[model samples]
Target chain A: MIKVDNISMRFNLGIEKNFSMKQFVVDLFSPSKRKEKKKKKVNNEFWALKNVSFEVKRGEVMGFVGTNGAGKSTLLKIVAGVMKPTEGKVSVGGNICPMIELGAGFDSELTARENVFLNGAVMGYSRDFLQSKYDEIVDFAELADFMEVPVKNFSSGMIARLAFSIATIVEPEILIVDEILSVGDAAFQKKSEAKMRSMISGGTTVLYVSHSAASIKALCDRVVWIDHGHVKMIGDAKDVCNEYLRSLGLPVEGEGNGA
Target chain B: MIKRVWLNFKKYSFLLKQLVARDFKIKYKRSVLGVLWSVLYPVLMMIVMSIVFSNVFKFTTEGVSYLAYLLSGLVMFNYFSEATNLSMSSVVGNFSLLNKIYIPKYIFPLSKCLVTAINFALTLIPLYVVIIIESFSYPDMKLSLLHLVLPYDYICLFMFTLGVGLILSAVTVFVRDMLYIYGIIVLIWTYLTPIMYDITIISNPILQSLMKLNPLYLYINFARQIILHGWMPTPAYFAACGGSALIVLLIGMAVFKMNQDKFIYYV
Candidate 1:
């Protein structure tokens, strides 16, 4: 289970036209010259998240949908514990495996097999466990032949597949995936979704973010619609997804929200 | 707080090993000489300094051979500089990893220090070789059991480098200009630490006391006392070296912890 309690994040965006530390230091000593630049203030404070509160119970696949820059990624990052919330607290129970970005910790100069252990270690897996499960991960990714090849040589799709395979090798208690469902080719996507289904069946709580409403409808038990850094709506997956689509001016397929 | 760090250490030991291993592998990946560069670097530096100081400056090495004296100071100083310099970039260099996952922030700088420590160990082979060669020329030069104290000196040096590294790496994330500024600072620091000259040459008591306050100088003096002079260091010397390490480590940890949470915003 994960709980985000009244969390908010604030960022300071610098507004000066030609701001540099060198110029700032120079301006510090010369007060008369600094007066000209005083018209443009240093920064503008903006809130990326505002008092967003939510809870994900164990064994629930919850989906987060929003437009670009709606703070979907920021919320997931806060939940994953990579970024601390500015105003509130978060409590997470159990091991969390966050696949926020494909191949985030990979060393391109290293081989695929080396990265398997490297990435697995980052996920807090023991060396012996990874060693035992090494072959299984390789078989799942179907990259057995390219295990020795450097990841820099691999295609983006290949890298994505490897990242997905290593992240899901062991069924984590909590899995946080960010728009990774559309990774790799269509066939591999199907395979990855099937793997996720099995993990969900084994009682893994998942927090997933994606732009595809259809996938959210198919997988998530409930959906949280976020807009302008606020929780716009939360309800059954179909209801929330349909409402989200309607807001986007996209046609609502088949039946309405009554269904 | 200590317990949390310890638990994270236990959990991420494998990841730390992988990171250190990756650093070592990447350093010599396409090079033909491979690990030999570790030894050759100090040897070349020793030869260059020996020629300049022994012949041109006519600097007295006291009773020790100039080559041995220079090599000893060069290796330790080089290790300190290399470790801290590499670690200064550790956080900024691993932005991708920091962005996607949450691991203890210290691990990046710590891994950089460990990799340099391994290379420093390799450089010791050439240092010892210089000592043995000098032993044949100077009858008073003999390897003693006191040389074992060199490892203690290395431990102190490691702690000091790691402490400074932690502070610099954390600062570098916010101030990108730190990279260029650190380069100039290291150059000046090398001259300040008396790496190529004997501290005894400075007859001023005030200057000598100030030199004693330098942590690197304390570590170098401890090593020289054991290896060059074949004598045990005074207890006061140990206190200076170890105390500086401890104090700097505490300060570094405090600074790093305060700034780490805001790192994502700046980076």
Candidate 2:
């Protein structure tokens, strides 16, 4: 089970642009454009998420549907334990296997074989478990012959296949995925979807964020529609996804109206 | 705090091992000499310094061979320099990884420091080689069982380096200025530590006294006592070396803890 209560995330939009002390000092001594900025001690706070809350029950598959910049990824990161929310609390009561940005722990200089072990360790799998699953990962990725080659030499598609293969090797109690279903070529995508279904049916709790409305309707038991950092709607997947797609001026599956 | 750190370390111990090995493999992957480069690097530096200091600076150790004294001080200072320099950028260098998944943020800096620690241990081979060669020349060279205490001194030195490295790594997440300024500070710090010259030759009492306050100076001085003078440190000396390291470590851990939650936002 997972609980997210009253979560908010704030970003200081322009802070990193003026990160240099030399630039600040130079601007301080000058009297032109930056003078007004210096007088106010310069701040640009943008709230990325505001007062949002949700819950995922054990063995439930929940989908998040939103436009770009709707704070879906930020909420996923908070639940994944990578980022701290500015307000509110999140409690996840099981082991998490996050597939946020696949290949997060890979070093390009390392071989595929080495990255399998390193990337697995980063996701909290023990070396022994990874060793036992090594062949399975290679077989699924279909890189058995290329395991010894450095990851830098692998094509982009090959790398993504390897990353996806290493990430889903375990049946985690809580799996937090972020827009990662589209990996490798078309054939590989079908295989990975099958793999995902097996994991979901094996009683794993899932929090999935994706752009594909069909995958959400196919896999999610429930869907949360977020608009501008607010939970716009939450209920059964088919209804919420229909409403979500309709709101964007696209025709719903069983409707004749079009934007 | 200790228990929490131990638990975190235990949980990530395999990750830490891979991180260390990843760097080790990358560093020597393209080189023909492989890890022998670590041993050869200090010996080569010692050769160049031996010529310049002996003839150009004309500095001399009264009863100790300059080669022995020079290499001992160089080995310890080099470890400190490399560890802290690399550790300072550890957090920002792994921005992609840190933002994507949850990692014990300290692991970045800790892994870099551990890699340098391995190289530092290997560099001791060069230092001992110099010691063996100088034993043939310097009549005062007494190869006794007391020299085994060198590894104990290294443990204390490692703690001090890691303490300083932790603080630098955490501070660097917010202040990009530290990245540029640390290079200049290290250059000045090397000159102030008496690594290339004899400290006793300075006539000014206050300047000499201030030099003694440097932690690197204290570490080098402590190791020299075991290697050159064959003297076991007094309990006060032991307490001073170990105590300062412990205090810095406590402060480092505290600073890292307070600032770690804000790191993701900044990085």
Whose lDDT is greatest here?
2
TM-score of structure candidate 1: 0.95
lDDT of 1 by residue, A1-259 (tens): 8998999988766533344778879999999878866643433567888889889999999999999999999999999889999999999998898988877789999999999999998888999999999999999999999999999999999999999999888878899988777788999999998888788768899998989988888889989888988999988999999999999998787765564
Clashes of 2: 0
lDDT of 1 by residue, B27-129 (tens): 9999999989999999998888888887899887778777877888889999989999999999998887888898888999999999999999999999899
Q: Which ten residues in a row have the lowest lDDT in candidate 1 chain B?
A: B137-146
- Candidate 1 docking class: medium
Native-to-model Cα distance after best TM-score fit, residue A123 in candidate 1, in Å: 2.0
Chain B TM-score against the true chain B, candidate 1:
0.96
Q: Using DockQ as the measure, which candidate wins? A: 2
Chain A TM-scores of all predicted models: 0.89, 0.92
All candidates: CA RMSD (Å): 2.5, 1.9
Docking class of 2: medium
